[model samples]
Target: MFRFLVGRLLILIPTFIGVSLLAFFPIRLLAGDPVALLSGERVMSPERHAEISHQLGLDRPYIVQYLDYLWKILHGDFGVSISQKQPVLDQFFQLFPATLELSLCAIIFAIIIGIPAGILAAVKRGSFLDQLVMGTALIGFSMPIFWWGLLLIILFSGILQWTPVSGRISLMYFFPSVTGLMLVDSLLSGEPGAFKSAVSHLILPTIVLGTIPLAIIARQTRSAMLEVLSEDYVRTARAKGLSTFRVVGVHALRNALIPVVTTIGLQVGVMLAGAILTESIFSWPGVGKWMVDSVSRRDYPVIQGGLLIIAGLVMVVNLIVDLLYGLINPRIRH
Candidate 1:
């Protein structure tokens, strides 16, 4: 296991380097100049442009700039955000917990709702319940998150007024951001109604963000369970007079989970990508919204740095998922 972990860590070195290269080059190729965008409405004079360029090392050759960026990254300097006027890493860390909280909640929601739905669908294959579960999963999978989020806002927030439209919490709450996670921070602050406010604000966006993953996980689980249920071991368990629950829950589901877990692991990337749309729609203060803003302003450091950091995070999640395989099924550790 140690050797396996070491090997995976070693693989990430080149993977991260490749990600850095991809993040760095593409942003520079974009048409808008970050310095010019930084000037806003004012026309940037040549001197002003040169001054900003020099300050940002944009005056340097592409190769030199790329090398310098990499060197700084190696030294733990993500460079300053031209727009925010803060360290890129600092801004990222500040926003990351919000994204983490949302993604974690979204995944948890998916797992709790999806897995059981899947198990039921598998147990009653070809029945109305199976069709209903599969049909809902299909529709959820097909729905666009942005559009769904808008519809939700229109119905729940606009018409019914059941949830807050956007933001992490109601403006009425003044919770200090201890962990940068609104839910946790609100509870810690002991601010009256803050936790409830946070949860209410979270519900719409969480549902929007989690929908696709829930669909995917449910389908994956159902498929895996169905395949596992047909195996000889499952039949043996049944023939041995094991309770239906024991046969399916202990034996079938456990074996089915290996592939289902892999599917869930792969969905981490999908979740992050989906968060970009969900966060933007919900105005959630997260790395996704930050990246979108950076793109508009052509904030090169933030864009490149954010992409690299997010990509690295995805890779880390995938590695952790791979490690989890050993825990779920010990044969993989060999």
Candidate 2:
């Protein structure tokens, strides 16, 4: 296990280098100039444009700029956002908690609802319940996140007036951002109604973000369970006169979870990708929305840094999932 972990960590070094190279070079090839975008609607003279480019190192050769950026990255510097004029890492850390909170809630919602639905569908293979569950999962999987988020806003916010249209919490509640997560910060504030307000605001976006992962997890779980149920060990458990719950839940589900867990791990990347759309639609003030706005303004540092960081996060999650395989099935530890 120790050697396995070391090997995985060693692999990440090159993986991150590749990710950095991919992130750095192509973005420079994009048509828009960050300095020009930073000037907004203003028309600058040639001399001023040249000065600004020189100041920002845009006048430097692409290879030179990339090497300098790579050196800075190695020294824990992501550079300042060309638009925001603040450190990219600082802005990212400020916004990341909100994204983390949303993603965590979304995944939890998916797991709680999806896994049981899957188990029931698998247990009752050809029954109506299975059909209904599978049908819903299929719909969830097929739906576009942006379209679904907008529909929810139209129904819940526009028509019913049940949920907030955008933002993390009601502006009525003021609290210092301890964790940068509205839900946690609200509770930490010790103010009246803040927690409820935060939760109310979270509902629509959470549902929108979670729906796809829930569908995928449910489908994976059902498939795994069906395969596991046919194995000799499952039949042996049933023949031993163990309760049906024990046979399915303990024997079948545990074995089935190996693949399902892998699917769940992969869903983290999906959730982050979907959050880009969901956050934009809802104006949720997370890293996804931040990155999107940066793209429009051609904020090179934020774009390159955010992509590299997010890719690194996905790699870390995959590593954790690999480690979890050993815990779930000891044979993998070898």
Candidate 3:
């Protein structure tokens, strides 16, 4: 287990460097200058631009800048945001809990619904229920995230008034962010309707973000369950007079989860990346939305730092998944 973890960590370093390269260089090549953008509607004079560029070290050669940034990253410095003029890491930590909260809820929502749907679909493979589940999965998977979010917002928030269209909570309730998660914080606040408002605001975003992952997990689960159900052990369990639930859920699902676990692990990365789209639509103040805003203003530090951190997180999640995968399969540990 130690060697396995060490190996995974070793693999992470180079990939993380690649991610830094992706995050750092491309944004610098973007049209327009952050220096000019800083001045807002008025264009800065060339002399002013040069002065600001030199001050911010933007005048340095691209290779030099990348090397310096890379060095700082190794020592855990993400530099300051070009636009916000704040430490990028500080902003990231402050906002990350929100993204983490949303992503956690979204993935949980997917797993809770998706796994069962897949299980039933597999068990009743030839029935209408199976077809309907798979059909819905197809639609959910195919639908664009932004468009789907808007549709939900219109239906639930606009017409039905079932949930908030955007933001984390109502402005009526204010509380210090003790844990950074609104739901938990709201509870701690002891304010009536605080937790309710947080949950209601979260509902649409969770549904929208989780919908695609749900489809993916459902399909993956169904496929895995189908394969496992046909295995000799599953039949043997049934022949032994094991109950149907025990035969399918216990015997089959235990083995089937090897691959399904991988799918769910991969979805964590996808969900993190996908949050950019969801956050934008709903105006959720998370890393995704921060990255989007940074792009518009060509905030190189924020963009690079945000992407690098998010990439690292995705890599870490994959590593944990691999460790879990080994524990589940056992054969891999050998």
Please write out the lDDT profile of model 2 over residues 241-292, one tens digit for every residue.
9999999999999889999999999999998999999999999999999999
Report, for every candidate in turn, its global Cα lDDT versus the true structure.
0.92, 0.93, 0.93
- Model 2, 239: alpha-carbon shift in Å? 1.8
Best by TM-score: 3
- Root-mean-square deviation (CA) per prediction: 1.6, 1.5, 1.2
Candidate 3: Cα lDDT at 271: 94
Point out the worst 10-residue segment of candidate 1 by lDDT: 170-179
Q: List the residue pairs that clash in candidate 1.
A: none
**Alpha carbon deviation, residue 253, candidate 1 (Å):** 1.2
When sorted by TM-score, best at the front, the candidate numbers are 3, 2, 1
Candidate 2 C-alpha error for residue 273, in Å: 1.3
Cα deviation of 175, candidate 2, in Å: 1.6
User: How many collisions per candidate?
Assistant: 0, 0, 0
